[model samples]
Structures are given as C-alpha cells and as structure tokens.
Target: MSTVHKAATVSTGEDRKPDVILDYNKTKGGVDCLDQMVAAYTCKRKSNRWPMVVFSNMLDVSALNAFVLWSGINPAWNAGKTFRRRIFLEELGKALVSPLIQRRKSVPRGAASLRMLNQIRGQPSSESIPSTSTATPPTKRKRCHVCTSNRKKTSTVCPKCREYICKEHSVTITTCHKCM
Candidate 1:
C-alpha cells in the first residue's frame, strides 16, 4: 500500500491574511472606543472592602455605556466629548435619587385603600396616621442615654446597647446613640 500526503497551499501577497481579520479589526475599534470611554472615568477608591469598589466601578461602566447609547440615538442632543464626566455622573446620580426621594415624599395608595376597605368592613384601623410634621416626634419618648436629660424627648432607641438617645445625641439618621 502506497501512502499519499496532501501538501498545504500557501497564499502569496495580499491574500495571505484571513477575511475574519478585517472584521476583527473593525469590531476591535468599537471595543477600544467603549474601553477608552469607560477608562476616562473609572472609580478608584482605596478601601478594605472590595464589594463596594467593584459595584461602584460596574455602575460607572454602565453609566458610560448608557451615555454612549443615548448620544447615538439622539444625534442632535448629543453632547461634545469635552463635556465633563463629573457633571454626567452627577446628573445620573440625581436621576436615580429623584424617584426614591419622590417615592418617600408621596404616601402609598395601597395604605389608603386598605384603610378604606377596613372602614367598609367595620374594622378599626390597626395604626393611627399622624399629621405631617417637619419634626417627627418619637413614638415612645425616653430619657437620653448620653446626656441623661429627662426633659428632652428621645426619638430613637439604640439597637446595639438598647439605650434611648435624643435626636441631638443621635450619630446617624437611622441608628441612635453610640451604635452609629
């Protein structure tokens, strides 16, 4: 039996490279453009916690991609490249925060509907709605742990130490006393 071997054909000059190389070059440019845009405003913070930093960087990249897509869709309203990333980021932050702030301000319709339904059923409402006041009075007023002043109204009780602390002595808006 005779063994036959097929020789590989080599392309000379212009045809030496594959057609996919051209497509790859074109696509690579787009990837480089997006990477450049993302790199322009990357979040770099020195912290012991890795999760927050990673999350923030992902958010930054997402924002950059959104901006690019928005600009592509609305050519007339497109901003110049010279536009500051800080301003864009600030606007993005405001856009995200505005809805939450509005949500907090407006009372949920479900609560009102539930109250009406309870009234129709002749059942007393479980909780009484308080009047809208700029200063929220404490549900259960107690003596301030820090100051030990019994006169001042304590708004929150510390969860950690289980001590009542007045608004003045509270470190954080949510957490009271030394637990903050």
Candidate 2:
C-alpha cells in the first residue's frame, strides 16, 4: 500500500533504441504478471520433472473444463523432449506477451467494493438480524474493512477504539495498543 513510486529506468523495446521509462513501480501488477509466468513455467517444470502428473492433470478428457481451455492444449504435445520444450517456451512467451497487449482489458476494481472496505475499516458492522422488542442490539462484527476474508486474525489493535486490522491494511502512522 506504499504510494511511493520509484523512478527506475527500464528498457522499452523499440526500433530506434531503448525507451527510458519513469513511472510508478506497481508491485501488485508485477506480482500478477509473475503469477502468470509461474503458472506457465510450472507447467513446463512439471513436464520435465513429472511427466505422468503433467499428463494426468492436463489430459483428463472426461472433465474437459475452462482451466484446460485457458491454459492451452493440455496433453503437452509429447512428440519429443525438444518439441515439448519448444512448445512450452512458445506457450510461455504467448502467455507473458498476451497480457501486455491486452493490458487495458483488465477489470478495474469498483467503487462500491472500495466504499464497503472503507466502511469496514471505519466501522465494521454486519447485517442486523432483527430481534424481539426486549432484545438488545447485536454485537458489532470485528473484521477487515478491506478483504473481509479474516475477522479476528488481525495483529494490530487500535489504541483509541481497539479495532483490529491486518498488517497489510493497518495505518503505519497510528500507534496500536501493543505499540502504546
């Protein structure tokens, strides 16, 4: 969540020469790209390391699904080691380059999700299951305002209000109870 942008010069493949780049170092974007590469590379690695696993996982024709379609022709083109390697390289190259070309096509995070996250961070309150007239107000659910995947696993507890927040989303400026 660091808004600090590092000005690192990287080469942009151009005919004239190299394009000097000065832009925000988006770690999230880089991580996503790396994930794709890892997935493709893992396929190749599996082929070389465990051919049987690669075959079984990829070539299960009975359950022909989206993963196989997205990943490309599964069975791994086991004509020969050289051919397989070449295909793997080619597939990897295609996988890496495709994202760059279709960069703008990525789905942007919505404002509602952000608002919900902010609400959670500011004041995390869940659905109020209605009760009888004599019943008391339901207890507020303590959960991450952002990725509401975790509830009591937060390390830093707010000093002022004692709100729990994950390390990733917790503000560095504010001192938690433990820090105090």
Candidate 3:
C-alpha cells in the first residue's frame, strides 16, 4: 500500500504533498529510511518465535548503523568499492567469531572441518603442551623450589626452565593481545 493520499492540495493547485515529508517530520523519516535499509540486507528468518525475530531485526539494524558509523569514521577504507558495506559486514561477522574459533580446543571430526581448524591453529602438532606429569622424588619428599626450603612440595614443572618449582616460585605471566 502506498503511503500517499489524495489530499485537498489539488484544489489549491499544488502537487500531492511536495514529497518533502522530512521538512515536516525529521526523525520518523529517518526511522523509515533505516527500516528500508535494514530490509535490504537482513539476517532475519521466518520464525514463529517473536524473540528470535526481534533479535534478528536488532542485529540487522545495529549492523547497518555500525556500517554507517564506520564509513563516516574511515571514509578512505575501501574507498571506491561498490559493495563496501556488504564486504564490511562480511568481514565484521568473521572478526566477531574468529577469536572463539581460534581458541577452540577440540578439532572437528570431519576431515574438511579438521583441516580448517588446523589451518586456523597454524601448528601441525600440539607437542609444546606442558606435561603436567609429576615425578615422585625417589627418597621421601622433594623440597620447594622457593621460600628457603619451606615444606611446600608443589611439583608443577616450570614449562620454560623444565624445573620442578613450587607455588611460591611460580609466576602467572600474561601478555597483551597485540603483543601476542
């Protein structure tokens, strides 16, 4: 159905409502434009569940809004590409879940999926996994590596030094994402 209506403007010899509705109502016109843009490229599916429908709509709208913001912020990005927004959304989707996929511990059972996971892992063998196996000191007990021989027999081996260090000697070191 058309939004236009035959108004009394014909008697006044003017066109059917100038077509400048934004000049009258600003925000509602933006809402309509946004709705139209979201409909063009949406993740929405035919579902009876209202929540899923709402969620998909939210995703589509937010994605469009984010694309607009990103384009405005970085106009030089993909400067002359015809499908810049679509490409941006595709890359954004990949980036959103890439960390989760990269950190996946279990490899897929299927050959293709396993290969894909391996490619993401960038390592052929999991050989560097530190062996948590503790060696029983032959005598009675082994002393702690730190704390002046305090009786804390933490048998965790230091991965780097290959030494049986106690909790006191162990340090949990972390690095930033960019450095990694």
Best by lDDT, which number? 3
State model 2's lDDT: 0.46
Could you tell me every candidate's TM-score relative to the true structure?
0.42, 0.19, 0.47
Query: Clash totals for all models, in order?
Result: 0, 0, 0
Clashes of 1: 0
Descending-lDDT candidate ranking = 3, 1, 2
**Candidate 3 whole-model C-alpha lDDT, 0 to 1:** 0.64
Which regions of candidate 1 fall more than 4 Å away from where they truly are? 1-32, 78-81, 84-87, 103-144, 147-180
Per-residue lDDT tens digits for candidate 1, residues 38-126, read 77777767777989888877887799878767667766552665674567677878999999999875655443465566678888755
Question: Each candidate's root-mean-square deviation in Å?
Answer: 14.0, 23.3, 14.9
Question: How do the residues 23-136 of candidate 2 rate in per-residue lDDT, one tens digit apiece?
Answer: 333335765654554454343333455767666546332123333454376655454465454464566568868988788446543334434554767753332212234444
Query: Looking at model 3, which ten-residue stretch has the lowest summed lDDT?
Result: 171-180
What is the full ranking by TM-score, best candidate first?
Answer: 3, 1, 2
Candidate 2: residue 84 Cα off by (Å): 12
Worst 10 residues of 1 by lDDT: 1-10
